[model samples]
Target chain A: MKKWVPTVIFLAVAVVLIVLAIVFLPVSKSVWVWIAALLTLAIFSILYRDNPIYRIAEHIFVGLSLGYGLAMIWHLALWQIALRPLFVEGRFILIIPIAIGLLYFTRLIPKVSWLVRIPISIALGLGSGIAIPLIFQATIFEQTKASLVLPEMFAPGNPWPGIWAIILIIGIVTTLAYFFFSRKEKSVLSPVSKVGIIFIMLGFGATFGLTVMSRVSLLIGRVQFLLREWLGIIAQ
Target chain B: MKRRIPLTLTLVLGIVMMIQFFIPHQFSQDFKNTALEWLRVIGGFAFIIGLASFITHHYTKIKHKKEGWAYSPIALGALVVMAVVGLIGRSPNMNWIPVTVQGQQISVFTYLFSNFFTHMMIPLGATMFSVLAFYIASAAYRSFRAKSLVSILLLVAAFVIMLAIIFYNVLPLGDLGEWLLSVPNMAAKRGILLGASLGGIATSLKIILGIERGYLGGTK
Candidate 1:
């Protein structure tokens, strides 16, 4: 019932586990394995109830993640992609982006925070503009093209592909129609949309199922790590 | 003066990038690359804003002795330690503060950085995500009741997919499962994709044309 009880229990268990691992496992991997196991257990503690150990693990994860991202962006995006080209490669034209990027520092000054929008607008505009044709190409053209039935699909005794193709196209159209918000109950889209809703449900179900399996796989991986590597209970 | 410059700049860059996509000449290709590089540079700077915001939040929390303020110090400390190690050590070629580990000459920063990432970060991150399995199961038990035909369809699809994948050797629904996904699932996904793409393209055009000014920060 006490607040400190969880922390004490976690520490006591961690100490025992580390000592046990060090005594049994290879010395080189023992320390890291035990530490990882401890962290894993700490995260797992949240499943039962919110505890100090879980909080510590959660905070540390957030901190380390942000730090990793920060360093990565600097090294990859800034140094390699942007700065090196400008300073070392004598690409002075990069000064345009450099100047724009410098504007981001204006956020620190309350009066000139609006200046930060310059860089933002540049990024947003370029990204949006680039996305327009690319989205159409990737999502619309390619997907529609793929949905079309080919002669080779029904070639030779494999006529099942033709039926499946018709079914797929029907599913796609009906699904799209279901999303047609402006259709009246008396309209042609009404019946089509009704069929669309069924496909949507099936899609949702499949997606949910797939998501659960993925998460379970992740859980299985961590469990295997604990059992095989740290505990040495399972064969390598 | 304030809004016009950004709006005009956005319009020019947007038009340029869009036009460059159509023109596949060496000059146009080079222009696109240059624009992307510029975007990357500016994007890198954008991260600092997030870093600053995070630090400010924790700093304020600690300063005011807010609820659970005790954890803020740990969060901030871990962030600083990881950032310092990562910045110095992660870069393979930078080789700051060189040290030998297991016959490899590497920086102490790199050694510590990698250990933290591998041991601390990976376990913590993976476990955090993995634990969601329990919550999802709990949610399914609590709210995923099959009271309607739609709900039953959803349950059947999810159950079939899970059963087929997890117990592929035991279940004979492999072909059916695959069909369900490739046919019905693909149909719905493609439908959603088409709609979303249209909306996204429209929004993008709106932003480029200065019609969507919300990102400019004010209603004005």
Candidate 2:
């Protein structure tokens, strides 16, 4: 038997099923619905095994994604900001950034490859500079402020909220200590890091469980589409 | 000459941007805004450059007639077709070809472009992510052994959170899960965030000061 035989049989079956589906399936008015439903099934096919149909869908997704991004850049940014300003509006100053942007292509030319660093440096400088003060304010200062105290502490006859706030603070302190403490310094209780480990584990586990559930929800949504939109077996 | 100029640019730009953040002057704000816009413009070019390499990779595969090379044409074809359609065809006034679909008059190019996103992109994207659900469960089953106190705590937290979400209204576990997230999870998150921000700020400072020239791609 030829290796191509399985592929041939699969294609033949797929074509026949598709034809039958077109004829017998309770059709929606929009052709895109059918296409989307078929693509969804193609993606779900990965659960069974990797095959040509899944590969085709995956490649199409990649191509379309890049194409979409490229078009948006052209339409929104490059066109509105750079091209129009350079051409129609006669704002010659915009050429500076466009020229810098074009320098990225210099990477392909080894001798001028050093020029590519111009853009890289600019990007890196911009990103790093912008990140510093923002990170300091948002992540460090704000988070510290939040964990330091809560309005719950002021609630009369409710020690639970105050306790919760205290626990959160301890959790933060111990966790920070865990981050700061050297491995050699981590004794049972002296280093304050062991308790941090427990909280970290708990946090990780909760995160994983939440991630799994989110995936499950996606699966449910696809299944719901198949049943409701494709098969017309379930109501909207 | 090559390294010095780029390094100097990084230093100047970084320091200037940082200093601009502290200034409340109108000129400072405008300078910051224009610099940000320029950054975005350059970022777009960066993306296109990345895509150029992507296309070149597939081209190389096809040129060499490498394994699974037959699929390269499909990938390239879709990319070119979508891009061509998006560039010239998505215009509202571009109904050169008379195409009516299900009683709506639409340009064939515009229709194709819109349909590619709606039919092709969303379905594949969502389903691709959902496919990971199976693998995650399989991996969890294999690794989630409750051998230690930490592992036990992990499993307990996982089960508690999962169960709480699944039967949120029916069980008291909802309150427990919410409290766990608010108190312990928030603590862990804030702790990690604080540490990371400090480290990140240090790294940024290092880069701004040109102590980290690793991005220049050579040992000087």
By DockQ, the best candidate is 1
RMSD of each: 2.0, 2.4
Winning model by TM-score: 1
Q: What TM-score does the A-chain of candidate 1 achieve?
A: 0.90
Give the lDDT of residue A41 in candidate 1. 91
Put down candidate 2 lDDT per residue, A1-236, tens digits, no spaces. Answer: 97667667776887797777668876566678889988998887677577888899989888888888888888777887888788989999889999999999998998788899899999999888888988977778878777766675858877787888888888888888788755565366555788888788888888888988999999999999877787676776
- Give the C-alpha interface root-mean-square deviation per candidate: 1.0, 1.2
Per-candidate TM-scores read 0.95, 0.93
DockQ of 1: 0.83
lDDT of the structure predicted as candidate 2: 0.85
What residue pairs clash in candidate 2, if any at all? Answer: none
For the predicted complex of model 2, DockQ is 0.77
Model 2, runs deviating above 4 Å: A1-25, A150-154, A181-191, B90-106
Q: CA lDDT of each candidate?
A: 0.87, 0.85
The local lDDT score (0 to 100) that residue B7 gets in candidate 1 is 93
